[model samples]
Target: MSRLFVTGRSGFVGQHLEAALLVLPTADWQLIESARFDLLDPASLDAALAETCPDAVIHLAGQTFVPEAFRDPQRTFEVNLLGTLNLLQALKRRGFSGTFLYVSSGDVYGRVDESDMPIAEHLMVKPRNPYAVSKVSAELLCQQWAYTESWRVMIARPFNHIGSGQNESFLVADMARQLVRIKRGLQAPVLHVGDVDVTRDFLDVRDVVAAYLLLLEKGQRGEVYNLCSGVERRVSELIMDMAHLAGVTVTFKQNPGKFRRAEQRRVVGCSEKIQKQTGWKPHAEFSETLLSVLSDWEVREAH
Candidate 1:
């Protein structure tokens, strides 16, 4: 049995990853989480690494929310950048050299030109926000370790992933929740939104977790792969889809507060690298995915 340690087990993707790991029939994986260690607490981290000495690690623990990162850049940097440094040092002190996957955001490729319709790994990264900047910094840091040490370090830049348990701070979840409320007559038949004209690449959190596990087993060391569906979806269309799924007719209202700083107007990513190598691509149907999200909100509202 291979011991696998994963950070950020409390986050949305982390939760899904944990669930995915639990049901895999092909491999025996002993999953370890960060309940006993703090990323900033090197002593605890060192002790934890010494104890577990995980055969592989997926580092998903970091400040991911853009607006929150803007509000607290220092804290974001401390967590995303310094926290990763601490983990690396702890692993080094423990003489641990294994596959280390650093989960990064597609936001790092901020402000891509429209000509670059489907972003690839070779394109230059222009980070436009604190959250994205911090991710890029950590990506480089982990890549550096991959080059210097024998660790199989890989970086995954996942695009906007949506699922049942996601909070309303994001676009799809917020719209789904609001539509659920509108269906239940808990709120008005109106949707408050940001720039709905913008487009993004969406993938199911189920598919995203599958890709992460595939990468852990088959991904090339010292390389970065983009994790996305390769389909550009407009936020307006998504809102419409969710409303239809929730059986609601809604009017749109502009919410100025919903706008994020340095928000990319359009995003689509090419997962060809991961596909050709690992034979992985998104398999969830768009409408089915939306229905699951809507059902999630419906169940949440029932409680």
Candidate 2:
């Protein structure tokens, strides 16, 4: 059986990816999560690589909060950038000759031009926020590893991924969680929102994980692939759709404080590269994604 070592096994994406992998039939793969403080302790990480000797490492552990990254840039870099370095170094030290999957974000293409509609992989990276900067830095680091050391690496830039098990801090989850509360009367009928007019390429976490697995199977080493829905939805429309799914009459309140600086008005990406390479296309429709998320929240609230 091939062993897969996942760095952020406890995160929302990590959890979903793990569950998805459990059901695959063609491959018998065992996923091992990081038990040590990844960025802070190098010795512990080295020990894990020595023991697991995994056939692949999916690096998912990092500081993901954009707003939080703005609040503490140093902390963001410490985890996203330095943490990635630690993992790469550990893998090198342990002499693990396996494919490394770097889970990056589409936010790396910050403040894109209108002509860059459906941003492609070749676009120049212009990270506006600390979170994007950190991800870009990590991507560069992974590229360096592939170029200098000849490590097999595939970088996946997944756009806004949403589904169940996601924390309420995220936009879609926040809307779903708030709608659940409003239905249960646990909170007011008011839903707090930041910039609802912004458009983003939101893909279901299921599709994103499938793309990751596809990358592992058919992706070219030393290449960067995008995982996107190729469909952009306004935040306002998403919340309204989610509210409609919940069958609730909720009022939305715009909280300026809740808004983050450097918020992009529109963000979309092209998954053509990945699709052409792996023949992977997203199957979940927007309505299905919305209803699924709301249904999951309702179940969670009932419990």
Candidate 3:
């Protein structure tokens, strides 16, 4: 049995990943709870590490919301960068010789040109927001540890992943929530949307978690991988699909408040490297994923 320590176990992606790990039929993997551990507290992190002695760790805890990061960049940096530093320090003090995976974001490739449609791992990182900047900074820190401390570290840059239990702060979840309300006759048949013209690469949260698991087993140390669908999908298309799934004819009204002035017009990624290394590919159908998200919102709205 191998012990695995996972940060942010209660968050959206973290929750899905923990669920996947439970059902996976490989080794007997045990999870170390992060509930009592605070990333900003070195003592707490050290205590958790000392108690668990994990064979591998998946770092998922961070200030994830972009708008929240914008509202407080200092806090974002403290949690993302300094928090990562403290974790590494604790592990080093414990003389850890295990695999560590840093879950970064594709937002690090902020505001890419059309020619950079399929952003690769080699593309220059141009972070456009505080959250993206923090991720990029943390990535650099992880890479440094990999090189200097001889720790087995890998970074994953995942694009937008949607699934059940996701808070409505996200774009797709917000759309699904509105659609659910409309379907239940609790609201009008009009969906307030942001910039739907922009395109993004989205994968199911389940698929994303699977890729993370594979990377833990097969990914090369100090290497970075992109976990994405490799398909550029328009937000408008997703909105339409959600509406159809909810059996509602909805009209969209552009919400200026929801729009991000620095948003990239198009963002896609190439997952070829990870596929070649781990033989991992997205298995969820787009419509099925969409329907699942809608169903999740329906359940939430009914309560």
Candidate 4:
């Protein structure tokens, strides 16, 4: 049986992917958590790859804070850029010939004007923030690796995917967490929000993982694919959905202090290439996802 290796196995997406991979009977999957290989440590990474000899390496470990990236570009670049370089070096040292799946973000295509309704995979990436710049750099590194050494490097630019295990840093999860407190009367009924008018493409974490698995199995080499729902929803709509899920009337309190300096007004991406290439499509409804997120938080809060 084939073996699979994954980084960032403790993160939100990593947790979902790990659970999803457990049901696949074809491969004996192993999650090499941060303990197994620190992205910053080259020797550790090399040792892990040499020991596992995985058929596929899903690179998901990195710094993932947008606002924090702005605060400390050094840490952002160090973690996102240098960390990826270390992994590439480890793979080279191990002479590991396996399909590599790099989890990129739609943030790399930052601040597209309103004219560009649905951004395509071929559009030029003009990152507006430090985090995005680091991701763009990582993608370039992956491309260079593919052209020079490997042919199985696939990049996935997934839009806003949210589900269980997401922390309070993200908007959806933040809202859900706050709603839980409000519903339980632990906090006020008023919800703090920032830039509600800005729209984004949101996908369920399960669908995102399915797309990643499909790309791992059938995606073409040295190509980038977008994983999105091809639709935009305002943050206000999401907050309202969470409120509806909570079955409580909630008030909103817009805090300009909470807004980021370079917030993109509108963000959306087209998943047509991935859909056509691998016959993969998103299956989770937006409402169902909202309920699921709320329910997941509810269970955690209850516990």
Estimate, for each residue in 1-303, the C-alpha lDDT of model 2 and write its tens digit. 778888888889889888888787865668865456556579888867776678888888999989899999999999999989998898888777888999999999999887889899999999999999999999999998989876689999999999988888888988898999998889898999998888999999999988888888889999999899998888888888788888888788999978989878998899999999999999988789888888888888888
TM-score-best of 1 and 2:
1
- 102-185 per-residue lDDT for model 1 (tens digits): 999899999999898799999999999999999999999999999999999999999999999998998899999899889889
Give the clashing pairs for model 1: none
Note the residue pairs that clash in candidate 2.
none
TM-score per model over all chains: 0.97, 0.96, 0.97, 0.96
In model 4, pairs of residues that clash are none
The per-prediction CA RMSD against the true structure, in angstroms, equals: 1.2, 1.4, 1.1, 1.6
Against the reference, the lDDT scores of all candidates come to 0.90, 0.88, 0.90, 0.87
lDDT of 3 by residue, 140-207 (tens): 99999999976789999999999998999999999999988888888899999888998989999999
Candidate 1 Cα misplacement greater than 4 A, ranges: none
Q: Determine which window of 10 residues in candidate 2 has minimal summed lDDT.
A: 32-41
Reference-based lDDT, residue 20, model 3: 88
- RMSD of model 2, in Å? 1.4
Residue 55 displacement (Å), model 2: 1.2
Deviation of model 1 at 195, angstroms: 1.0
Candidate 2 runs further than 4 Å off: none
